[model samples]
Target: MVKINKMLKSLHISNYALIDTVDITFDNGFNIITGETGAGKSIMLGALSLILGERADIKAVRDSGKKSIIEATFEIDDYPTLKEYCLANDIEWDDTMCILRREVAPAGRSRAFINDSPVTLDLLSHVAMQLVDIHSQHQNQLLTSPEFQLRVIDSMAGNDTLLSDYRKRYAAFRSAVKRLHEAKRKIEQNRSDEDFTRFQLEQLDAMNLVADEQEQLEHEREILSNMTDIKSTINGALDALLNGNSNALSLLSEAGDYCEALGRILENADSLAERLQSARIEIQDIADTLSAFDSDLNADPAELDAIEERLNDIYALQHKHHVSTVGQLIELRESFRARLDELENSSFTIEELEKEARRAKSLAKELAAQLSKRRAEEAARFEADLRERAMPLGMKNLQIKVELTPTELSSTGADSIRFLFAFNKNQPLMPVGGTASGGEISRLMLSIKAIIADKMQLPSIIFDEVDTGVSGDVANRMGAMMQSIAANIQVMAITHLPQVAAKGNAHFKVYKQDDEHSTHTRIRRLSTDERIDELAVMLSGSTVDNAARANAKSLLNIK
Candidate 1:
C-alpha cells in the first residue's frame, strides 16, 4: 500500500445552513457519514464546499446575527504542487498543516482566508483543488465529456511530458500561423497604398529637388525680374565715379597732384596727398565693379523663362508632397524610397513566414500522431481494466469498449475517442450514456475512478451518495472497494446504505435537533456501540428490531 501523508485533518463549521456549529476531526482512512433522509450529511458537504471556495449565500447562516464560517485543515507535506501554490499566493503555511477558511455574512458578502492570511477566492480554490476531489454525481456526468475523457487517457498513458510538449508546440504553431496572417495583412495593406506612394516618389525624383536649390532659384528670379533697373543704377554710378571728366576719381587725382606739390614744402601736405591717393584708388575700384555688373546684367528672356519653369516645378512638387522646403521634400523622397524597398522585400518575408508555419504544422502533426498512438494503447488497457472492475460489482455482462477514431488534429490530438458500452452480450455496443442506466453508470463511474486512482495520485476522494440505486451484495462490494481505495488515500462516503456505512473505519451520523422556535442540524462521530445502533436504524428504518441489530453487528464483525 502507498503511504498516505496528505489528509483532511479537521473541519470546523459554525452557523452554517442547518448546523449552528459542528466541528469534526477526520482519520487517514475510510470515514463514512450516514443519516436518515433530510438529515444534514449533504449540508456538511455543502459547508466543506464553502471552504473550498464555493460561492456562499447569506441564507446559509443559521443565526441571522452571526456569520457562517467554514474552515478546513489538511496535512499537505506530501503535495509539492500545493506547496508551490502556497508560495505563489504568499500564504503562510508549513508542511505539517494548512488551514482554509471561508466566511459568509448575513449581508451576502463573503471572504476567504488560507493560513490566517486573506486570499482571493480563485487562489483559495486553486489550493483547495490540489488537496481534494469531491466526486459527486455531477462528476459522474463528466465521464461523457471529451476533455475529461482525454485527460483520463493521458493520465493512464503517463503522457504528461508528451502531451505537454505537444501542447507547447501546438501553441507555437498557432502563434506562427497568427504571425503569418499578420504579415500577409501588412503586405496587402502596403500593396494597397504602394501605387500612390510610387507616384509621389516618381514626381519628386523627376524634379530632382535639392536642398537650397529653391532659395537659389528665388534669388536668381529676383535679379532677372529687376535687371533693367539694376543696369541703369550701376551705369549712373560708374559715370559719376570714373567715366565723366569731372568724375570723383578725376577730382581726387587733381587734388592729389596739388597736395604732392605742397608736400615738397610742408609735412602736413604729404599726409593730405596720401589721403587723396587712397580715395582715388577706392573710387576707381568701385567704378570697375559697377562696369562689370552692367555688362553681366543682360535681360535674357529665354534663361529667365527656364529658371521660372524650374522654380514652378519645384514649388508644385513641394505642394504635392505637402512640404514647405526642398529639404522636406528630400526627406519625403527618402521615406518613399524605404517604403518601396520594403515592398520589394515583403514577398521574401512572407515566404519565410509561410515556411515557418508549415514546419510548425508538420511538427505538431507528428506529435499529435504520437499522442494518439500512445492513447490508443492506454485506452485498450483501460477498457480491459474497466470491464474487469465492473465484473466484480455485479456487472458481469457489462461490455465497455474504448474507441479512438482518427479526427482532425486539435490541442489534444487527432482522435475522437468514445467509451462504448453494451449491457447484454447480444446487443450492439452504444455510447455509455445511451446504454447504461443511472445505477449502472454510477457503478461504471466508480470502477473507472478506481482505475484512475490506481494510475494517479489523488489526495482524497469523496463519493456523495454514489451508491444511490444499489443495495445488497453489490453495495457491500462497493463499500469494500471504497475501503480498499482508502488504504492508500483518505476516502469519504456520504451514504444511506447500511452495508456501505458498516465498512467505514470511522463512522459519523448527521441528525436534526428541534427547539421551540426552530430546528437545527448537527453531526457527531459515532462510538462503536453508537455505530451499531445507527447501522441498525439504517438497516431497519425507524423501527430497529433485534434482527436488524444482529445484522448490523454481523456487517461490522462485532461479537
Candidate 2:
C-alpha cells in the first residue's frame, strides 16, 4: 500500500510522438496550463497513464524512434508486495520506494517501475490505483446506478455489517407483507355476492325456529290434522251426559233421587244427598268446558286437507335446506341469523388498513432518525475538511455542505446527500451542476478533492479544461485553486485559461508540423524564451502583438 503524500513531482518523456523529449517537474499540488487549440496539451496526462500500465501505442512513438519513456517520482512508502511485483516484472523500484514509472516502445511492449524497481502494468495499476483515482465524465452519468446508490446508502448508514442484516430482513418482511395483502385481496375478489348472501340468510332466518321448535310445531300440526274425528267423538260423549238414558249425568240424577228417599228413612241420608249434588255440579262444569272445545273444532275435510298440505310444505322446505329435521333447520337459522345481525354493525376494511399504515410509518420514522444521526456526524466532518482545504485556494468563501432532510423510507433509505457548493461569499450554495457555472465546478471539484483526498489517496487527479465555461477573474481563481490542490496531490489539467497556464511549474507545447511522408505531431519542453513566447502568443494571439506580449510579461511577473 504505497501512499502518495506528494503529487507527481516531475516527468521525463522521450520519443513519445510529438513529445520527443521533455523534462518537467510538477508542483506538489494543482498545475494548470493554457495553450492554442490543437496543442499537444493531452501529452502530459497521457504519459502518466502509460506509466501506470495502459496499452502501448506503436504510433505514439516518434517516427524515427524505437522506444518511449515516461518517468515520475512520487512521495510514497515502500510497499513490500509492490516491491516484489516490480522485481518480478523487470521494472525498477528505487530507494524512495514511493516513485512509479513506466516505459513503452514502438514494438507494442510496455514496462512499469515503482521506486526505480521493475513491475508489471497490472502490478503498477493495482498499486497506483489505490494512490490515485480518475473519476472521468462517463462514469458520472451512472450516479443513479443501484450499485452506486447502495454504496452511498452504506456510507451514510455507517454499518456495512448491519446493512446486510437489514437487506435480508427487509426482503423477508416485504415478501410476507405482500403475500398477506394479496391473499386478502383474493379473498375479497372472489367473495360471495351481496344479493346471494342476503337471500340465503333471509331464507334460513325466516324459520324463526329454535333447535326444538320444529319438533313441537310438527306435533301440534299432527293434533290439528285430527280435528274433525276428535270433535265428533267428543260431541257424542257430551250428548250422552246431557240427554241420553244411559248418560252418566242422568244415571247420577236417578241415583240421587233414590238416595233422597233413603235419606228420609235414615238420619245420615241428607248428608249423602248433599254430597251427591256437589259432585254433580263439578261434573257439569267439566262437561261445559268439553262442549266449548267441541263447538270450536272444525269438522270440514277441506280444512283438514289444507292443514296436511301445509305440513308437507314445511317438510319440503326442510329437505331443500339440507336439514335432517326441523330442529337442524332451526339450529342453522339461529347461528346464521346471529352472524347477520352483527354484520349490520360491521365497519369498513379501510379502518384496519389505516391502522396498519400508521404502524409502519412509526417504525420507519424510528429507523430514519437513527440513520440521520450517524449521517450528521459524517456530514459535519466532511464539510469542515472541505472548508479547511479551500482556504489555501483563496476560497475563504467556499462552503461545502451536505443537506439531509427527513424523507420517507424509500429503497434508498431516508437520506440523500448531494454535493453542494458556494464559490462566492454569501452566495447560496447550489448543487454541483447548478447555475454555479464551469469555473465554479472546477473549484468545487478541487474542494471535493480537499474533502475526499484522504479517502481517495491516489497519485493523480486530472482536470481537462475543467474551467471551460469561465474566464477572467473566476478562471484565475480556478487556476490558483487547482495549483494549491496539486501541492499535495497530482493535478494534471489541460486548460485554455491563461491564468491556469501560467501556474504550471513545468510547461509543454504541442503543435503539428509536416515531414516528407506525413505531418507529424511535435511536443517539446519550453525554454525560458519559448515559454514567454508561448504565454505571449496566448495573451496576444499568434502575431505576438506588442501590447499583448507586454501584458503577458506582466502576468508572468505577478508574485
RMSD of each: 9.2, 24.7
Q: What shift in Å separates residue 375 of candidate 1 from its native position after superposition? A: 1.4
lDDT of 2 at 221: 66
lDDT of each: 0.86, 0.63
Name the top TM-score candidate.
1
Positional deviation of residue 266's Cα in model 1 after best superposition, in angstroms: 47
Q: Which stretches of candidate 1 lie over 4 Å from their true place?
A: 52-55, 78-98, 116-127, 197-339, 424-428, 457-459, 515-518, 540-554, 557-559
Error of 2 at 99 (Å): 4.8
How much RMSD separates candidate 2 from the native structure?
A: 24.7
Q: Write the per-residue lDDT of candidate 2 for residues 352-414, one digit (tens) a residue.
A: 554565565555555556666766777777667667755455466777777777665654456
Could you tell me which residue pairs clash in candidate 1?
A: none
lDDT of 1 by residue, 34-88 (tens): 8878988878888888766788877788888978889899986677777776887
